[model samples]
Target chain A: MRHALILLGVLMAGMGLSVEAGLLGPLGEQVGHLSATLSIFMVGALLLSLALVFAPKRQLGALFKQPRWLLTGGILGPVYVIVLTLATPLVGVGMTMVGILCGQVAASVAIDHFGWLGSEQRKVDGYRIGALAMILAALWLM
Target chain B: MLLPLIFILLLVGGAVLAAQSSINGRLGAKAGVIESSWLTFVIGAVLTFLLMFFFEPAQQATLFSVPKWQLTGALFGVVYMLAIVFAVPRVGTAAATVAVISGQLLMSLLIDHFGWLSNAVRPLDASRYIAMALLIGAIGLIYLSHQQRHRRLASQPS
Candidate 1:
C-alpha cells in the first residue's frame, strides 16, 4: 500500500505537469516562453519557501557546500518548460508529449546502459532494445 | 525547419528532465525531498530570471492582466517536481519516469479533447487510442524487464 500510494502520488504529479504544459502554451503566446517560465519559476520558489517556513529547519547552507552537480537540481526545469512551451503551439500537447517520451526513454536507457550521470550500469540487451522499439513505434503511430 | 528544431529542443528538454530527477533524487537523499525541491526552486528562479531578462522581453503588463488561474502553472510545477524528487529514490528513475509518462499521456488526451486552456481541440480517434495502447504496452514491457533485471541481480552474490 505504501508503494502504491507513492506511485499514485507520482501519477497525480504527472497529471499536474500535463496541466502546466497545457497552460504554458497559451501563456507563452501572450508572454514569451522565457518570460512565462521565469514567472512560473518565481512562483514555484515562493511556494517552496512558504512550505519550508512551516517545516523543521535544516542546515540549508550545507547544500551549498555539496558538489556543483547536486546543487544545480533546478536547472533543467526551465529548459523543459521553455521547450515544451515552444513545441506546444506548433505540434500540440499530444505530439509534444510523444516527442518528450521518446527523448526521455532514450536518455533513461542510455543512462542505465552507460552508467552515465552516477547511475548503476544496467546492460543494454535485446529486451531493453525491444521495449524502446515499441515506444518509438507508439510515438510514430501517434 | 523551425518546427523540427522546436521538436528536437523539446526532446532534449525531456532528456534533461530525466537527468534532473536522478540528480535531485540523490540530492533528496541528503536534504530530504521538500528541502531538495526548495533548493531546486532557488536555482531555477535565478536561472529563469536571467533568461527572462536577456532573451525574453518584459511582459509584466500582459502577465498581470491575464486570468488569475493562468498564474497557477507554478503550483502544478511544484507538485510535479516534488513528486519526481520523492519517487526517484523509491522507484528508481526509469520506473518513476514511466509512471509520469503514463499520467502525462492520459492528461494530454483529456486536454486535447476538451481544448482546455485555449488549446486546439483535437477530438479522440481510433488511431490516437491505438497509439495510447501501444504506449501502455511499452510501459508494461519496460516494467517487466525492470523487474526481471532486479530479480536477476538480487540472486547474484554480492
Candidate 2:
C-alpha cells in the first residue's frame, strides 16, 4: 500500500507537468510562441531564484571543473521550447505530442542501453521493447 | 518534407529533455538540487531573451493582457524540472521516465475529458481507457525489470 502511494505521487507530478505543458500551446497562440517561451522561462527563473535565496550556499566552484557536458543542460532548454513552438503548428498538438513521446521512450532506452550522461547501463531486453511498443500504441490512441 | 522535419525536431526535443534531466542530476550531485535548477532556469532565461529579441517583437500589449493563470506555465515547469532532478538519480533514467510518462498520460486524459486549459473536450472512450491500462502495464514491466536487474547484480560476487 505504501509503495502504491509513492508511485501515485510520481504519477501525479508527471501529470502536473503535462497539464502545464498542455496549457502552453493555447497561451502561445495568444502571445507569440517565442514570447511565450520567454515568459515561461522568466517565471521559472524568478521562482527558482526565490527558492534559492533561503537555501544554503554550496561550493559552486567545483562545477567549473566538471566536464563541460555536465554544464550544458541550459542549452537544451531553448531547443525544447523551439521544438514545441514550431512543431505544434505544423503537425497539430496531438501529433506533436505523440512524436515527443516516441522520442522520449526511444531516447531513454538508448541512453540507458549506452549508460549515457551518467545513467546506469540497462540492457535492451524484450520486456523493455514491449514497453516501448505499448507507449507508441498509447500515442496512437491519443 | 516539412512534416518529417517537424517530427524530427520533436524527437530531438524529447531526447534533449532526457539529457537535461541527466545533466541536472549530475549538477545536483555537486550543487544542491534547488541550486542546479535555479542555474538552469537562469541560463534558460538568458537564452530565451536572446531568442525573443531575434524572433519575436516585444508584444507589450498582449503580454499584460494574458490571463494571470496562463503565466503559471513556468511554475509548472519549475515543478517538473525539480521532479526530474530528484527522480533521475534515485530511480535511474528509464524507470523515472516511464513513471513520468504514465503520469503525463493520466493527467492528459483528465485534461482532454474536461477540456481543461481550453483544450478540446475529448470523451474518455474505450480506446483511451485501454491505452491508459497499457501504460500502467508498461510501467509495471519497467519497474519489474529494474528490480530484477538490481537483484541479479546484487546476487553476483563483488
Candidate 3:
C-alpha cells in the first residue's frame, strides 16, 4: 500500500512535467530558451526557499553535512535543461525525448546491475529485459 | 557529426539523470525531502542564472512581462522535484524512475490528444493507444521485478 502511494506520487510528478512542457513552450517563445529555463529554476527555488523557512531546523543541518559528491546530483538539472535547449531545435522534440527515454532506461538497468550510487544490486535478468523491451516498443510507437 | 554527438550527449545526460535520482534519493533519505528538493533547485537556479546571464540573447518580453498564469507553470517543476525526492528512497532508484517515466509518457499522450495547456490537438490513434498499453505493462513488470528482488533479498542472510 505504501509503495503504491509513492509510485502514484512520482507518477503524478511525471504527469505534471508534461503540463509544464506545454506551458513552457509559449514562455520559451517569448523569452529566450535559456532565460525561460532560468525562470523555472528561479521561481521553483524561490518557492522552496519559502517552504524551507518553516521546515524543521534539524533537517536544515542535515542538508549541509552531506558528502561533497552528493551535491553533483543537483547539477544534473542544469545539464539536462541546457542540453535539451540545444538538442530540441536541432533534433526536434520527439527524437530528443526518445533519446532521453532510451538513455534513462539503459542507465537505470546498468545502475541496478552494478549497484551504483547505493542502489541495490539487481542484475538485468529476464524480467528486467521484458520491461525494457516493452519500454522500447512504446517509444518506437511514439 | 555534430547531430549524433548532440544526440549521444542527451543519452548520457539521461543516464546521469537516473544516477541523479539514486544519489538525490539517498540524500533525501539522510536529509529531508523538502531539503533535498530545495538544494537542487538552489543549485539549478544559481547555475542557470549564470548561464542565462552569459548566453541568453535578448528577447522582446521578459518573464515579468509574460502573463501571470504562465509563471505559475514553473511551480509544477517544484512538484516534480519534490515527488522524485520523496519517492526514490521509498521505492529505490530504478522503480521510481520507471514509474515516473511511465507517468510522463502517459500524460504526454493525453495532452497531445486533448490539446490541453494550449498544445495542438493530436487525436489519439491506434499507435498512441498501443504505446500507452505497453507503458502500463512496462511499469507493472518493473514494479513486480523490484518487489520480487527485494523479497528475495529479505529472505537471504545478511
Candidate 4:
C-alpha cells in the first residue's frame, strides 16, 4: 500500500512535469514573458521554505552542509525550467521534448553506467546502447 | 518568432539541469522534500535572474505583471515537485518517466490540435500523427530496455 502510494506520487510528478512542459512552454510564448517561469520557481521556493519553518524541528542543517551535492542539484532547477520554456516556442513542445528526451535517455545511460555524482553504478550493455540509438532515430523521424 | 524558439531551447536545457539536480535532491532530501526543493529553487531563481539580466534586459520587467492565466503554471509546478518526490520511491524513475512522457504527449496533442488555449497553434495532420507515433515508439523502446535491465539484475545472484 505504501509502495503503491509512492508510485502514484512519482507518476503524478512526471505527469506534472509533462503538463508544465506543455503549458509553460506555450504560456511563455503567449505572455511574451519568461519571467513567469522564474516567478513560479520563486513562489515554489517560498512555499517550501515556509513549510520547513513551520514543521517539527529536525536536523536540516546536515543536508545543507553538503554544499557540493546540494549546489550541483540546486542549480539545475532553473536551467531545466528555463531551457524547457525556451525550447517550446522554437521547435514546438513536442519536438522540443523529443530532443530533450533523447538527451535525457543518453545521459541516463551514462549516469547509470558511470555512477557519476554519487549515483548507484549500473552496468551498461548492448541493450542500453541500442535503446539510445532507437530513441535518436525516433527523434529524427519525428 | 525566433525569440520563442530561443526560449524553448532554454527550457530544454533547464530540463537537463533539473534531471541532474533531481539525483542530488534524492541524495540530500533526508532533511525534507520542502527543504531540498526550496534550496534548489533559491539557487535556480538567482541563476535565472542573472541570466535574464545580461542577455535580454528589455524583456525583463521591474514589476511583475501576473497574467490571469499564467498562474496555472505555478499550480502545475507545485503538483510536479510533489509528484516527482512521490514517484521516485515507488515505481523507480524510468517507469515513472514513461508515464510522464506518455501523458505529456497526449496532452500536447490536444493542446496543439485544438488550440485549447489562446495563441496555441493547431497542427492536425499526417505529419503530427507521424511525429507522435515515433515519440511513443521511442518511449516504449526505452521502457523495454529498462525492464530488461531490471529482469537481468533480478536473475543475477548477489
The best candidate in terms of lDDT: 3
Which of the two, 2 or 4, has more TM-score? Answer: 2
Docking class of 2: medium
Write the residue-wise lDDT of candidate 3 on A14-70 in tens digits: 888878887787899898877788888889888999999987664778878998888
Q: How far is candidate 4 from the true structure (C-alpha RMSD, Å)?
A: 5.1
Compared with the true structure, what per-residue lDDT tens digits does model 2 show for residues A1-142? 3334445566777988887778776677777777777787889889888887766775556667778888788889898888887787778878888888778877878888899988768898777887787877887786
Measured with C-alpha atoms, the lDDT of residue B56 in candidate 2 is 85
Query: Could you give the candidate ranking by TM-score, starting with the highest?
Result: 3, 2, 1, 4
* Model 4: interface root-mean-square deviation in Å: 4.6
Candidate 2: stretches off by over 4 Å: A1-9, B57-60
Instruction: Write the residue-wise lDDT of candidate 2 on B1-158 in tens digits.
Output: 88888888899999887778778877877767787787788888899889878878555447579888888878778887887777677666776677788889988998989998778898899999999988898887777776777788899978
The runs of at least 3 residues in candidate 3 whose Cα sits more than 4 Å from the true structure, single-residue gaps closed, are none
lDDT of 3 by residue, B24-67 (tens): 88898889888888888889888989988998889999988988
Q: Compare candidates 1 and 3 on TM-score and give the better one.
A: 3
Task: Give the worst 10-residue stretch by lDDT in candidate 3 chain B.
Answer: B88-97
Docking class of 3: medium
Q: Which number leads on TM-score?
A: 3
* Interface C-alpha RMSD after superposing true interface residues, each candidate, one decimal: 2.7, 2.1, 1.4, 4.6
Choose 3 or 4, whichever is better by TM-score.
3
Please report, as a residue range, the 10-residue window in candidate 1 chain B with the lowest summed lDDT. B135-144
Candidate fnat values, all? 0.67, 0.69, 0.80, 0.41
What's model 1's lDDT at A44? 89
Model 3 per-residue lDDT at B96: 80
